[model samples]
Target: MIEVDEVCKSFTVRRRSGRLRRSRTLVGAVDRISFTVAAGEFVGYLGPNGAGKSTTIKMLTGILTPTSGRVRVSGLDPSRQRTALARRIGVVFGQRTTLWWDLPLRDSLTLVRHLYRVERSTHQARLAELTELLELGAFLDTPVRQLSLGQRMRGDLAAALVHDPELLVLDEPTIGLDVISKATVRAFLTRLNTERGTTILLTTHDLGDVERLCRRVMVIDHGRLAYDGSLPRLRAALDADRILIVDLARAAPPIEVDGARVVRTDGPRQWLAIPPSGNAAAVVAAVAARHEVEDISLREPGIEDLITRLYGGGVPADR
Candidate 1:
């Protein structure tokens, strides 16, 4: 439902020099990035701060023009047919609200219905469903400024979908939300993608959101696409070593296990890095034979760690 072909976007940023001298430089925010999203797929666009994620989203939503290349959302060129494309897409920016601040939640939704030219009956039905699903009935009459952060976010989401757009572009939709609120938002988004077949492109710093909701993820760094594919594939590619942490009942002599490296040792606990090709069972057996084992746990590197390594310009360590 979304196709971006070698899209490039740059901003002219002003730089100040000594003695009040100024210089204008073109900072490339998105450079030659290309990807396609199929209908009904929920994809996560992930990166660190200033990794061009927001720039790409803005270009896709027609909020900013690209310096070169092409972008199409739902078969329409966003820059060329912005108004027409807007009707086919819904965008929720976490730090910004599209709803009228002075209007009640219900009134704002009504205004959006009129703005979208939705039929009265269709509007009412959609509103009713959204109100029930989003649990917005309690504060339907509350002004935007009076609602809590979580409530405001839910209301924004509802407003974005009032016209039933085919595609949803959510930028940091769950940022700064409490755990319960985050779970609620994630559940709603999952339902929207699974039940309604809404094409969703999400940009989030929260790795848990990506891990739980997105099957496909695209990682960007330094204005370029670093990785794009199934989340499992990315994880497998980055984490080639399985880690085992063993806690002993008492400190024992330094032990050696074939094909495993001793990564760290602290008192009675030892950390071992097992290569992907190595047999973890053999290593465990060896450790068990030598040490008084109290407990053992295996872990793999998390997505957050992989992302940090990617942006930090270090190769992802093998699992």
Candidate 2:
């Protein structure tokens, strides 16, 4: 539902030089990045600070026009057809709320319905559904400014979806939320994609969000597309390793395993590094056979590690 071709965005900024002298320097935020998102697909877009993620999202959402190349959303040019595109897409910014701070949650949603010109009956039905799914009934009459962070976020999600847009673009939808709140948001998004068939483009710093909600992931670094594929392939491309944390019944030295090596230890707990090709079950069984294991857990390589690898040099040749 989204397409970008050879897109580039640049800006000119003046910097003070010696004394009263100044210099105008050109900066590239997004550099010839091209990608596509099919209808009903949930994709994760990731990057660190100043990585051009926000710039790309702004261009896609029509907030900013690119300096070069073309961008299309739902087959419409975002820059020229933004007014029409707004009707087909929903955007949620975690740091800010779209609702009116002084108005009750219901009233704020009502305003959105009116602004979108949705029929009264349709708006009621949609609001009812959102209220149930997002559990907004408790604070439906509460002022936005009075609600907790989680409540405000849930209310924002309802406001974004009140018009039934075809695509949803979320920027850190679960930021600063508690674990339960994050889970609720994730579950709702999963249903929105699977049952409602609403396409999703998620940009988040939380790897947990991507790991739980997205199947296909994209990594951008230094204003360029570094990788785009399934998470499994991403790990394989980087030869990423997983950590196995084993808790023994008593303190002991590092346990030796054929496919894994000890990377850290604390009392009876030990961390073992398993290669991408290593079988975690086999390693666990080996460790259990030799050591008195009380508990065990596995941790996949974090997104930060992959991003660090990519930024350390250039994109991986295999990717």
lDDT of each: 0.89, 0.92
lDDT of 2 by residue, 1-319 (tens): 9999999999898999889999999999999999999999999999998989989998999999999999999999999999899888999999999899999999999999988889999999999999999999999999999999999999999999999999999988999999999999999999999999999999999989998999899998879999888887777778778999999999998899999999999999999999988999999999989888899999989988877876785655343
Best by TM-score: 2
What's model 1's TM-score? 0.88
Query: What are the root-mean-square deviations of the candidates from the true structure over C-alphas?
Result: 3.2, 2.1
Tell me the tens digit of each residue's lDDT in model 1 across 211-270.
899989899888888888877777666655778899999876555878788888898888
Alpha-carbon runs more than 4 Å astray in model 2? 247-254, 266-269, 292-295, 313-319
Q: RMSD to the native, candidate 1? A: 3.2
lDDT of 2: 0.92
What lDDT does candidate 1 reach at residue 27?
Answer: 94
Model 1, stretches more than 4 Å misplaced? 247-260, 265-270, 277-296, 309-319
Scanning candidate 1 in windows of ten residues, the lowest lDDT window is: 310-319
